[model samples]
Target: MTGRKVIGLREAVAAHVRPGATVYLGNFGAQLFAVGHEIIRQRRTGLHLVIGSGGILLDQLLGAGVLASATFGHCWSPVGPGPTWNFRRAAESGERPVTLYELSLGLLTAALTAGAWDVPFMPVPGLPGTGYTDENWPNGRTSRVDSVFGAADVVAAIVPDVAFVHVDQADADGNGVIPGPLGETLVAAQAARAVVLVAEEVVDTGTARRAGIAVPGLLTSAVVHRPGAVAPDGAIGRYERDVAAYERYVARAATPDGFADWLAGHVTGGRDA
Candidate 1:
């Protein structure tokens, strides 16, 4: 859709996402904390999150029991050696655990690429020994294929029900200009059935075009103007990553009670809290 009206974060998320939906949360660094927090606040449950790299936001979803499953190449805080405590706890605990699908970074990218290309699968080399080539893999999403070269493993395409992206700016037409690294945001946006772009600013179409629009308006279902939405995670040149906030989150989210307290005092209290 073109010339889309900018909407509130809550409204955009509520209108686009549904319970038990398979959702893609854009790139690792450009992850939309505002969207994630809104989903939590709205108590949207049974979500299956697809991410390239799972970080604090994914941990929040896991801790809140909003996720039915998670598919990712890896899970860890960008800050340090500390693991994502909630994800770790959920995976390790026998209680109501979130189903984990661990795939290589290459495979994850291949899946998105295949989806973007509207293909059934994308072949990748050197996946035969990764243990994912077997049918026993949790979801049986990968399989071996014979090629002219030899046998190769191909990952099934993953088209999320909805995708959320955070960008530096966008136009009222929903064309987004995402500065810095491209990462997986573009592919995820294209692969999803619907897309929500949360931008720092909504500018004129000419401004967005001149700024080098990375995501076209045709792929965007909605645009949300949310300044500093990706806080605790940098938005390239717009702001620096909040290391202290991330550290605080890690410390507070280390336990269930601590996570609850942090959620109540910080996330649920609004971004400024």
Candidate 2:
């Protein structure tokens, strides 16, 4: 545990974070949003985030003016990162919206490819009423990703600048394996430049020692131990969405102030007086 082996939270974040850099993220069970918010709370720089299928954390940042711009697929579903289509409509119409750059219409998985590859356009067919699409954005989806050359940047979907992911377990090398197939976490890690992992427990390295990883070891910049990262009220582990909480949030989403109120009650830590 000596030199360059274990690092602090601040050092880990500062290592990969730069102003104007786009970020990808993963969620733990219930405390994910809190960790993301803590980073924002610590850093003074304005961060632009590109979320895949996101959740309340992104919305909170947007509402707080912490995020300069955001692009994502599904963030409005009652579940985590809700439905991208719903967020798109709100953003385009300037209703309950923040400044957002559009990715082609698809899933959060697609957005990662767009930013990592830096593609001007992505073709996605069957976009409800919109039909197939191409967009000059850092977010979009279509058929299976076929490297960035044919599309543009074969490395386009090759990891973002700073990826924040929360997992159940990881080793000291920052090598992690998800409990199971997660939402958009593993994909985000694969496409990010440097990743900061938040794990409940840092375990021994076993199969994780095998390299040729989907998210290579070098790609992992740091690991923080903080359990209960997401929120049981919003996301139901790897099972289902928090139905009741989501139903309440849609109404609160009508205004930033309302969203803040919700956060104050549940997520945000502050004096109640």
Q: Per-prediction count of colliding residue pairs?
A: 1, 31
* Lowest lDDT 10-residue stretch of candidate 2: 150-159
Residue range 1-273, candidate 2, lDDT tens digits: 222434665566666667667766564233366456665655535666766545555656665556656765435555553443334444667454345654432445555655555664334433433423344333332343456555332212334677887665667787766654466566567667678876655666775554222344566777776555555433334334456666576667666566667656654453210
Cα RMSD to native, each candidate? 2.7, 6.0
Residues 1-273, candidate 1: write the lDDT tens digits. Answer: 235467788888788779999999877556677788888888899998998767888888898888999988677888875678898897788874788887776777788889999999988775445466543442666778887888876888989999988789888878999887777778889899998888888898889989999999899988988898888788777888888888888989888999999988877777432
TM-score of 1: 0.91
Worst 10 residues of 1 by lDDT: 129-138
C-alpha lDDT score of every prediction, in listed order: 0.82, 0.55
Work out how many backbone clashes candidate 2 has. Answer: 31
TM values, all candidates = 0.91, 0.66
